[model samples]
Target: EFLENYFLGIFTCEAILKIIALGFLLQPGAYLRNVWNLLDFTVVITGYITVFAQTGTGIDLRTLRAVRVLRPLKLVSGIPSLQVVLKSLIKAMAPLLQIGLLVLFGIVVLAIVGLEFY
Candidate 1:
């Protein structure tokens, strides 16, 4: 199992590297930023197929929960779309976060006043 998994990893890495080399060498798809996301999707789908193939119609909800826990991996795996999305969300929410903190303080103050008055 270890050897098979190791070889599969090497094969996938080599294939992805070849495609990236070709992209650079041929200057293809320069406009798209999430080009590498396709590779991540391919790898993840391949993993799911392998697991299902080995187990034969028996995947529990707990197993699925663990799998879904990796949902953020779609963003964290250096895929450009996810990276840019997280960046944009942070940028957009910075001021909102600050405002939320102020709101929280106001709520705390109001709660204290109500407690003291009542």
Candidate 2:
């Protein structure tokens, strides 16, 4: 718990610093303008929500803690190579989905043929 809170505090500080330096939403290169920063903001906010819920508030927001799993993905923003790879993967998704559907159709057709023969 101590370690979790420690890391949460670090992430929170980073988010605050970025927001201050880049501005929030209006500027051209604002912090929230970048998707990664938006994700970082979400993770930090969810962390606080869970902490407050567990500490003082009567609200049960434990499910929000599951979002903490995305915290590691924050590293992608720090690494340009990872960002490139991720963007490539996102671009490939539509073609990949089509290929996957084609393969599934072939499998289904073969299964139907085998059933008729048997």
| TM-score top scorer | 2
For residues 25-113, write the lDDT of model 1, one tens digit per residue. Answer: 33555212344555454555565566566678654435433543444554465566777877788798989999999999999999999
Clashing pairs in 1: none
Q: TM-scores across all candidates? A: 0.40, 0.87
Model 1 misplacement above 4 A: 1-87
Off by over 4 Å in 2: 57-63
Query: Candidate 1 — number of clashing residue pairs?
Result: 0
lDDT of 1: 0.60
Error of 2 at 10 (Å): 0.4
